[model samples]
Target: MLEARNLYSYYGKSVVLQDLNFDLEPGSMLAVLGRNGVGKTTLLRTIMGLTDRTKGDLFFSGEPLGDRRTDERAMMGIGYVPQGREVVPRFTVAENLKMGTFARKDGKRAIPDKVFDLFPILKEFSERRGGDLSGGQQQQLAIGRALAMNPKMLLLDEPTEGIQPNIVQEIEEVIQTLNVEHGLTIVLVEQNIDFARRACDRFLVMDKGQVVVSGRGEDLNDEIANKHLTF
Candidate 1:
Protein backbone atom coordinates (compact mmCIF):
# COMPACT_ATOMS: atom_id res chain seq x y z
CA MET A 1 0.00 0.00 0.00
CA LEU A 2 3.04 2.24 0.46
CA GLU A 3 6.56 2.34 -0.97
CA ALA A 4 9.66 4.43 -0.48
CA ARG A 5 12.96 4.39 -2.37
CA ASN A 6 16.18 6.09 -1.32
CA LEU A 7 14.14 8.24 0.99
CA TYR A 8 16.19 11.02 2.56
CA SER A 9 14.61 13.43 5.00
CA TYR A 10 15.83 16.69 6.46
CA TYR A 11 14.95 19.10 9.21
CA GLY A 12 16.19 22.54 8.13
CA LYS A 13 19.61 21.91 6.51
CA SER A 14 20.62 18.74 8.36
CA VAL A 15 19.58 15.41 6.90
CA VAL A 16 18.00 13.08 9.49
CA LEU A 17 16.94 10.08 7.40
CA GLN A 18 19.50 8.61 5.04
CA ASP A 19 18.67 6.59 1.94
CA LEU A 20 15.93 4.52 3.55
CA ASN A 21 13.73 2.19 1.56
CA PHE A 22 10.79 -0.07 2.36
CA ASP A 23 7.46 -1.34 1.06
CA LEU A 24 4.30 -2.14 2.98
CA GLU A 25 1.58 -4.33 1.53
CA PRO A 26 -2.11 -3.80 2.03
CA GLY A 27 -3.44 -5.10 5.38
CA SER A 28 0.10 -5.68 6.71
CA MET A 29 1.88 -4.24 9.75
CA LEU A 30 5.52 -3.09 9.85
CA ALA A 31 7.47 -2.50 13.04
CA VAL A 32 10.24 0.14 12.91
CA LEU A 33 12.60 -0.41 15.85
CA GLY A 34 15.65 1.55 16.87
CA ARG A 35 17.23 3.27 19.84
CA ASN A 36 16.68 6.96 20.57
CA GLY A 37 17.51 9.51 17.83
CA VAL A 38 18.09 6.90 15.10
CA GLY A 39 15.56 8.56 12.77
CA LYS A 40 12.55 6.36 13.49
CA THR A 41 10.34 9.36 14.13
CA THR A 42 11.78 11.15 11.12
CA LEU A 43 10.67 8.31 8.88
CA LEU A 44 7.05 8.83 9.87
CA ARG A 45 7.34 12.63 9.70
CA THR A 46 8.81 12.41 6.22
CA ILE A 47 5.94 10.20 5.13
CA MET A 48 3.51 12.82 6.41
CA GLY A 49 5.45 15.67 4.73
CA LEU A 50 6.10 17.33 8.07
CA THR A 51 9.81 17.73 7.47
CA ASP A 52 11.34 20.80 5.87
CA ARG A 53 12.83 18.90 2.91
CA THR A 54 13.01 15.37 1.53
CA LYS A 55 14.56 13.59 -1.41
CA GLY A 56 13.63 10.44 -3.32
CA ASP A 57 10.34 8.77 -4.08
CA LEU A 58 7.27 8.15 -1.94
CA PHE A 59 4.18 6.42 -3.26
CA PHE A 60 0.88 5.73 -1.56
CA SER A 61 -1.41 3.10 -3.00
CA GLY A 62 0.49 3.39 -6.32
CA GLU A 63 0.38 7.20 -6.74
CA PRO A 64 3.53 9.24 -6.23
CA LEU A 65 3.33 11.71 -3.35
CA GLY A 66 5.50 14.38 -4.88
CA ASP A 67 5.46 17.71 -3.08
CA ARG A 68 2.03 17.08 -1.65
CA ARG A 69 1.18 19.28 1.33
CA THR A 70 0.61 17.59 4.70
CA ASP A 71 -3.13 18.15 4.50
CA GLU A 72 -3.22 16.75 0.99
CA ARG A 73 -1.51 13.61 2.21
CA ALA A 74 -4.07 13.31 4.98
CA MET A 75 -6.84 13.53 2.38
CA MET A 76 -5.07 10.65 0.67
CA GLY A 77 -5.71 8.54 3.80
CA ILE A 78 -2.57 8.69 5.99
CA GLY A 79 -3.18 9.02 9.70
CA TYR A 80 -0.31 10.00 11.99
CA VAL A 81 -0.28 9.71 15.78
CA PRO A 82 3.01 11.29 16.67
CA GLN A 83 4.93 10.62 19.89
CA GLY A 84 3.58 12.27 23.05
CA ARG A 85 -0.04 11.82 21.99
CA GLU A 86 -0.48 15.45 20.98
CA VAL A 87 -4.16 15.76 21.59
CA VAL A 88 -5.59 19.25 21.86
CA PRO A 89 -5.34 19.96 25.54
CA ARG A 90 -8.17 22.43 25.93
CA PHE A 91 -10.65 20.81 23.55
CA THR A 92 -13.29 18.42 24.71
CA VAL A 93 -12.77 14.79 23.73
CA ALA A 94 -15.52 14.96 21.12
CA GLU A 95 -14.14 18.15 19.62
CA ASN A 96 -10.64 16.75 19.37
CA LEU A 97 -11.96 13.70 17.50
CA LYS A 98 -14.05 15.86 15.20
CA MET A 99 -10.90 17.70 14.14
CA GLY A 100 -9.61 14.55 12.51
CA THR A 101 -12.62 14.32 10.17
CA PHE A 102 -11.59 17.59 8.55
CA ALA A 103 -9.20 15.62 6.39
CA ARG A 104 -11.84 13.21 5.05
CA LYS A 105 -12.22 13.27 1.29
CA ASP A 106 -15.95 12.49 1.44
CA GLY A 107 -16.49 15.59 3.64
CA LYS A 108 -18.45 13.58 6.19
CA ARG A 109 -17.77 14.73 9.73
CA ALA A 110 -19.27 12.08 11.96
CA ILE A 111 -16.80 10.06 14.07
CA PRO A 112 -16.83 6.47 12.91
CA ASP A 113 -18.53 3.94 15.16
CA LYS A 114 -15.48 1.70 14.88
CA VAL A 115 -13.46 4.29 16.78
CA PHE A 116 -15.85 4.11 19.71
CA ASP A 117 -15.72 0.33 19.57
CA LEU A 118 -11.96 0.31 19.68
CA PHE A 119 -11.71 2.80 22.55
CA PRO A 120 -14.85 2.79 24.58
CA ILE A 121 -13.40 5.27 27.08
CA LEU A 122 -13.50 7.93 24.38
CA LYS A 123 -17.26 7.64 24.25
CA GLU A 124 -17.58 7.72 28.03
CA PHE A 125 -15.38 10.78 28.31
CA SER A 126 -16.80 12.57 25.30
CA GLU A 127 -17.64 15.70 27.27
CA ARG A 128 -14.41 15.85 29.30
CA ARG A 129 -11.60 18.18 28.41
CA GLY A 130 -8.64 16.37 26.87
CA GLY A 131 -6.22 17.91 29.35
CA ASP A 132 -8.25 16.54 32.20
CA LEU A 133 -7.77 12.90 31.24
CA SER A 134 -5.05 10.58 32.50
CA GLY A 135 -2.12 9.59 30.29
CA GLY A 136 -3.69 6.32 29.15
CA GLN A 137 -6.98 8.02 28.40
CA GLN A 138 -5.20 10.66 26.37
CA GLN A 139 -3.39 8.02 24.40
CA GLN A 140 -6.65 6.34 23.49
CA LEU A 141 -8.03 9.75 22.49
CA ALA A 142 -5.07 10.27 20.20
CA ILE A 143 -5.61 6.93 18.44
CA GLY A 144 -9.35 7.53 18.22
CA ARG A 145 -8.71 10.97 16.74
CA ALA A 146 -6.57 9.39 14.05
CA LEU A 147 -9.21 6.75 13.33
CA ALA A 148 -11.76 9.50 12.89
CA MET A 149 -10.18 10.26 9.53
CA ASN A 150 -10.84 6.74 8.20
CA PRO A 151 -7.27 6.37 7.03
CA LYS A 152 -6.04 3.51 4.84
CA MET A 153 -2.62 3.65 6.50
CA LEU A 154 -1.80 4.57 10.10
CA LEU A 155 1.64 5.75 11.27
CA LEU A 156 2.01 5.37 15.02
CA ASP A 157 5.08 6.61 16.91
CA GLU A 158 5.42 4.89 20.28
CA PRO A 159 1.75 4.46 21.01
CA THR A 160 2.55 2.63 24.24
CA GLU A 161 5.10 5.03 25.64
CA GLY A 162 4.70 6.44 29.18
CA ILE A 163 1.59 4.45 30.02
CA GLN A 164 0.82 1.84 32.68
CA PRO A 165 1.30 -1.81 31.78
CA ASN A 166 -2.42 -2.58 31.55
CA ILE A 167 -3.05 0.30 29.17
CA VAL A 168 -0.06 -0.73 27.13
CA GLN A 169 -1.67 -4.14 26.70
CA GLU A 170 -4.92 -2.46 25.74
CA ILE A 171 -3.17 -0.39 23.10
CA GLU A 172 -1.36 -3.46 21.84
CA GLU A 173 -4.62 -5.33 21.43
CA VAL A 174 -6.10 -2.34 19.60
CA ILE A 175 -3.15 -2.27 17.21
CA GLN A 176 -3.56 -5.96 16.52
CA THR A 177 -7.27 -5.54 15.92
CA LEU A 178 -6.65 -2.63 13.57
CA ASN A 179 -4.31 -4.75 11.47
CA VAL A 180 -5.64 -8.31 11.81
CA GLU A 181 -9.35 -7.67 12.02
CA HIS A 182 -9.90 -4.25 10.41
CA GLY A 183 -7.06 -4.62 7.90
CA LEU A 184 -5.59 -1.16 8.31
CA THR A 185 -2.05 -0.84 7.02
CA ILE A 186 0.18 0.26 9.92
CA VAL A 187 3.76 1.44 10.34
CA LEU A 188 4.50 1.24 14.03
CA VAL A 189 7.55 2.91 15.61
CA GLU A 190 7.81 0.89 18.80
CA GLN A 191 10.33 0.27 21.60
CA ASN A 192 8.75 -2.79 23.21
CA ILE A 193 10.28 -5.75 21.43
CA ASP A 194 7.79 -8.24 22.84
CA PHE A 195 4.83 -6.26 21.55
CA ALA A 196 6.58 -5.72 18.23
CA ARG A 197 7.08 -9.46 17.80
CA ARG A 198 3.54 -10.23 18.86
CA ALA A 199 1.80 -7.64 16.65
CA CYS A 200 3.88 -7.02 13.54
CA ASP A 201 3.99 -9.05 10.33
CA ARG A 202 7.41 -7.62 9.40
CA PHE A 203 10.19 -5.71 11.12
CA LEU A 204 12.84 -3.13 10.22
CA VAL A 205 15.74 -2.15 12.45
CA MET A 206 17.09 1.33 11.94
CA ASP A 207 20.55 2.56 12.86
CA LYS A 208 22.42 5.78 11.96
CA GLY A 209 19.36 7.00 10.03
CA GLN A 210 19.21 3.96 7.75
CA VAL A 211 17.30 0.69 7.66
CA VAL A 212 19.98 -1.92 8.35
CA VAL A 213 17.99 -5.09 9.04
CA SER A 214 14.53 -5.94 7.78
CA GLY A 215 12.73 -9.26 7.52
CA ARG A 216 9.67 -11.26 8.53
CA GLY A 217 8.61 -10.79 12.14
CA GLU A 218 9.74 -14.26 13.22
CA ASP A 219 13.27 -13.42 12.13
CA LEU A 220 13.67 -10.61 14.68
CA ASN A 221 15.42 -12.73 17.28
CA ASP A 222 17.67 -12.06 20.27
CA GLU A 223 20.82 -11.61 18.22
CA ILE A 224 19.35 -8.86 16.04
CA ALA A 225 17.89 -7.13 19.09
CA ASN A 226 21.15 -7.23 21.01
CA LYS A 227 23.18 -6.05 18.03
CA HIS A 228 20.96 -3.24 16.77
CA LEU A 229 18.48 -2.42 19.53
CA THR A 230 20.15 -3.03 22.91
CA PHE A 231 21.14 0.12 24.76
Candidate 2:
Protein backbone atom coordinates (compact mmCIF):
# COMPACT_ATOMS: atom_id res chain seq x y z
CA MET A 1 0.00 0.00 0.00
CA LEU A 2 1.02 3.64 -0.62
CA GLU A 3 -0.22 6.06 1.97
CA ALA A 4 0.03 9.85 2.22
CA ARG A 5 -0.98 11.24 5.55
CA ASN A 6 -1.63 14.88 6.33
CA LEU A 7 0.46 15.85 3.35
CA TYR A 8 1.38 19.42 2.50
CA SER A 9 3.33 21.08 -0.31
CA TYR A 10 4.32 24.57 -1.48
CA TYR A 11 5.89 26.59 -4.24
CA GLY A 12 8.17 29.31 -2.84
CA LYS A 13 5.98 29.63 0.28
CA SER A 14 2.67 29.59 -1.57
CA VAL A 15 1.02 26.47 -0.20
CA VAL A 16 -0.40 24.17 -2.88
CA LEU A 17 -1.45 20.96 -1.03
CA GLN A 18 -2.80 20.98 2.48
CA ASP A 19 -3.25 18.07 4.83
CA LEU A 20 -4.12 15.76 1.97
CA ASN A 21 -4.54 12.11 2.89
CA PHE A 22 -5.07 9.12 0.59
CA ASP A 23 -4.17 5.50 0.07
CA LEU A 24 -3.74 3.29 -3.00
CA GLU A 25 -3.97 -0.45 -2.80
CA PRO A 26 -1.93 -2.86 -4.82
CA GLY A 27 -3.25 -3.52 -8.34
CA SER A 28 -5.85 -0.76 -8.07
CA MET A 29 -6.23 2.68 -9.67
CA LEU A 30 -6.84 5.95 -7.82
CA ALA A 31 -7.83 9.01 -9.81
CA VAL A 32 -7.01 12.49 -8.58
CA LEU A 33 -9.57 14.91 -10.01
CA GLY A 34 -9.86 18.71 -10.05
CA ARG A 35 -9.80 21.69 -12.35
CA ASN A 36 -6.57 23.25 -13.60
CA GLY A 37 -4.32 24.99 -11.03
CA VAL A 38 -5.88 23.11 -8.12
CA GLY A 39 -2.48 21.62 -7.23
CA LYS A 40 -3.17 18.21 -8.71
CA THR A 41 0.23 18.14 -10.39
CA THR A 42 1.86 19.33 -7.18
CA LEU A 43 0.40 16.35 -5.35
CA LEU A 44 1.96 13.93 -7.86
CA ARG A 45 5.27 15.78 -7.64
CA THR A 46 5.21 15.50 -3.86
CA ILE A 47 4.57 11.76 -4.08
CA MET A 48 7.51 11.37 -6.46
CA GLY A 49 9.59 13.69 -4.21
CA LEU A 50 10.07 16.17 -7.08
CA THR A 51 8.35 18.69 -4.80
CA ASP A 52 9.13 19.13 -1.14
CA ARG A 53 6.69 17.80 1.42
CA THR A 54 6.50 20.41 4.11
CA LYS A 55 4.49 18.13 6.38
CA GLY A 56 3.13 14.57 6.69
CA ASP A 57 4.49 11.17 5.80
CA LEU A 58 4.62 9.14 2.60
CA PHE A 59 4.68 5.42 3.15
CA PHE A 60 5.24 2.97 0.33
CA SER A 61 4.85 -0.69 1.10
CA GLY A 62 4.78 0.45 4.75
CA GLU A 63 8.19 2.14 4.51
CA PRO A 64 8.40 5.89 5.03
CA LEU A 65 9.81 7.81 2.04
CA GLY A 66 10.90 10.87 3.97
CA ASP A 67 13.31 13.29 2.35
CA ARG A 68 13.98 10.79 -0.43
CA ARG A 69 15.25 12.19 -3.72
CA THR A 70 13.28 11.79 -6.93
CA ASP A 71 15.62 9.26 -8.50
CA GLU A 72 15.80 7.37 -5.24
CA ARG A 73 12.04 7.11 -5.20
CA ALA A 74 12.03 5.87 -8.77
CA MET A 75 14.52 3.20 -7.80
CA MET A 76 12.10 2.19 -5.06
CA GLY A 77 9.33 1.45 -7.59
CA ILE A 78 7.69 4.83 -8.08
CA GLY A 79 7.25 5.68 -11.76
CA TYR A 80 6.00 9.02 -12.99
CA VAL A 81 4.76 10.51 -16.26
CA PRO A 82 4.78 14.26 -15.80
CA GLN A 83 2.20 16.47 -17.50
CA GLY A 84 4.17 17.59 -20.56
CA ARG A 85 5.15 14.10 -21.83
CA GLU A 86 8.78 15.16 -21.35
CA VAL A 87 10.31 12.84 -23.92
CA VAL A 88 13.84 13.72 -24.97
CA PRO A 89 13.07 15.53 -28.18
CA ARG A 90 16.35 14.47 -29.78
CA PHE A 91 16.24 10.83 -28.76
CA THR A 92 14.64 8.09 -30.79
CA VAL A 93 11.60 6.28 -29.44
CA ALA A 94 13.72 3.32 -28.48
CA GLU A 95 16.26 5.55 -26.75
CA ASN A 96 13.58 7.31 -24.71
CA LEU A 97 12.32 3.97 -23.39
CA LYS A 98 15.83 2.93 -22.50
CA MET A 99 16.04 5.81 -20.04
CA GLY A 100 13.64 3.99 -17.77
CA THR A 101 16.00 1.07 -17.42
CA PHE A 102 18.14 3.11 -15.05
CA ALA A 103 15.38 2.89 -12.47
CA ARG A 104 15.76 -0.84 -12.19
CA LYS A 105 18.03 -2.03 -9.38
CA ASP A 106 18.50 -5.68 -10.36
CA GLY A 107 20.96 -4.78 -13.15
CA LYS A 108 18.49 -6.02 -15.76
CA ARG A 109 19.80 -4.42 -18.95
CA ALA A 110 17.17 -5.59 -21.37
CA ILE A 111 13.94 -3.73 -22.09
CA PRO A 112 11.18 -6.24 -21.51
CA ASP A 113 9.35 -7.50 -24.58
CA LYS A 114 6.12 -6.77 -22.70
CA VAL A 115 6.70 -3.06 -23.11
CA PHE A 116 6.71 -3.49 -26.86
CA ASP A 117 3.53 -5.55 -26.61
CA LEU A 118 1.88 -2.76 -24.66
CA PHE A 119 2.83 0.01 -27.04
CA PRO A 120 3.53 -1.72 -30.33
CA ILE A 121 3.57 1.60 -32.15
CA LEU A 122 6.83 2.34 -30.34
CA LYS A 123 8.42 -0.77 -31.83
CA GLU A 124 7.30 0.32 -35.26
CA PHE A 125 8.70 3.79 -34.63
CA SER A 126 11.77 2.45 -32.88
CA GLU A 127 14.12 4.65 -34.88
CA ARG A 128 11.85 7.68 -35.13
CA ARG A 129 12.76 10.87 -33.27
CA GLY A 130 10.58 11.50 -30.26
CA GLY A 131 9.91 15.09 -31.29
CA ASP A 132 8.73 13.95 -34.70
CA LEU A 133 5.81 11.96 -33.32
CA SER A 134 2.36 13.50 -32.95
CA GLY A 135 1.19 14.65 -29.53
CA GLY A 136 -0.78 11.46 -28.91
CA GLN A 137 2.07 9.23 -30.06
CA GLN A 138 4.44 11.13 -27.82
CA GLN A 139 2.12 10.49 -24.91
CA GLN A 140 2.22 6.76 -25.69
CA LEU A 141 5.99 6.92 -25.76
CA ALA A 142 6.01 8.69 -22.42
CA ILE A 143 3.89 5.98 -20.81
CA GLY A 144 5.96 3.32 -22.53
CA ARG A 145 9.12 4.82 -21.09
CA ALA A 146 7.65 4.81 -17.62
CA LEU A 147 6.66 1.17 -18.08
CA ALA A 148 10.20 0.30 -18.97
CA MET A 149 11.03 0.57 -15.28
CA ASN A 150 8.58 -2.26 -14.60
CA PRO A 151 7.40 -0.22 -11.65
CA LYS A 152 4.98 -1.49 -9.05
CA MET A 153 3.35 1.92 -8.80
CA LEU A 154 2.69 4.46 -11.58
CA LEU A 155 1.72 8.10 -11.44
CA LEU A 156 0.31 9.94 -14.44
CA ASP A 157 -0.75 13.56 -14.85
CA GLU A 158 -3.36 14.68 -17.38
CA PRO A 159 -2.48 11.92 -19.86
CA THR A 160 -5.55 12.56 -21.94
CA GLU A 161 -5.04 16.28 -22.16
CA GLY A 162 -4.84 17.49 -25.76
CA ILE A 163 -5.05 13.89 -27.02
CA GLN A 164 -7.38 12.67 -29.75
CA PRO A 165 -10.41 10.61 -28.74
CA ASN A 166 -9.08 7.31 -30.08
CA ILE A 167 -5.74 7.80 -28.40
CA VAL A 168 -7.48 8.75 -25.18
CA GLN A 169 -9.35 5.45 -25.25
CA GLU A 170 -6.12 3.58 -25.82
CA ILE A 171 -4.54 5.21 -22.78
CA GLU A 172 -7.54 4.33 -20.68
CA GLU A 173 -7.33 0.70 -21.77
CA VAL A 174 -3.64 0.63 -20.89
CA ILE A 175 -4.39 1.92 -17.41
CA GLN A 176 -6.93 -0.85 -16.90
CA THR A 177 -4.62 -3.57 -18.16
CA LEU A 178 -1.83 -2.38 -15.92
CA ASN A 179 -4.04 -2.66 -12.89
CA VAL A 180 -6.02 -5.82 -13.66
CA GLU A 181 -3.61 -7.85 -15.76
CA HIS A 182 -0.26 -6.77 -14.37
CA GLY A 183 -1.19 -5.91 -10.77
CA LEU A 184 0.35 -2.47 -11.08
CA THR A 185 -0.86 0.26 -8.75
CA ILE A 186 -1.78 3.56 -10.41
CA VAL A 187 -2.39 7.08 -9.16
CA LEU A 188 -3.77 9.20 -11.97
CA VAL A 189 -4.31 12.96 -12.11
CA GLU A 190 -6.79 13.65 -14.85
CA GLN A 191 -9.16 16.43 -15.89
CA ASN A 192 -11.59 14.39 -17.96
CA ILE A 193 -14.14 12.62 -15.80
CA ASP A 194 -15.16 10.46 -18.74
CA PHE A 195 -11.70 8.95 -18.89
CA ALA A 196 -11.45 8.73 -15.12
CA ARG A 197 -14.87 7.20 -14.94
CA ARG A 198 -13.77 4.41 -17.20
CA ALA A 199 -10.27 3.77 -15.86
CA CYS A 200 -10.16 4.35 -12.10
CA ASP A 201 -11.56 2.21 -9.32
CA ARG A 202 -11.61 5.17 -6.92
CA PHE A 203 -11.12 8.93 -6.98
CA LEU A 204 -9.97 11.88 -4.88
CA VAL A 205 -11.30 15.29 -5.78
CA MET A 206 -9.15 18.26 -4.82
CA ASP A 207 -9.91 21.96 -4.65
CA LYS A 208 -7.91 24.84 -3.18
CA GLY A 209 -5.20 22.36 -2.26
CA GLN A 210 -7.49 20.04 -0.32
CA VAL A 211 -9.24 16.79 -1.18
CA VAL A 212 -12.85 17.81 -0.75
CA VAL A 213 -14.49 14.62 -1.94
CA SER A 214 -13.54 11.02 -2.51
CA GLY A 215 -15.27 7.72 -3.19
CA ARG A 216 -15.36 4.49 -5.13
CA GLY A 217 -14.70 4.87 -8.86
CA GLU A 218 -17.48 6.68 -10.70
CA ASP A 219 -19.29 6.59 -7.39
CA LEU A 220 -18.11 10.17 -6.85
CA ASN A 221 -20.75 12.81 -6.38
CA ASP A 222 -21.75 13.88 -9.88
CA GLU A 223 -22.80 17.36 -8.81
CA ILE A 224 -19.45 17.98 -7.16
CA ALA A 225 -17.54 16.43 -10.05
CA ASN A 226 -19.40 18.70 -12.43
CA LYS A 227 -19.03 21.76 -10.24
CA HIS A 228 -15.33 21.40 -9.54
CA LEU A 229 -13.99 19.50 -12.52
CA THR A 230 -16.03 20.84 -15.42
CA PHE A 231 -15.28 24.22 -16.92
Clashes of each: 0, 0
lDDT of 2 at 23: 85
lDDT of 2: 0.88
Candidate 2's residue-wise lDDT over 137-193, tens digit each? 999999999999989899999888899999988988888888889989999998878
Q: Model 1 off-target regions past 4 Å? A: none
Best by TM-score: 1
| TM-score of every candidate relative to the true structure | 0.99, 0.96
- Measured on C-alpha atoms, candidate 1 has an lDDT of 0.94
Report RMSD (Å) for each prediction in the order shown.
0.7, 1.2
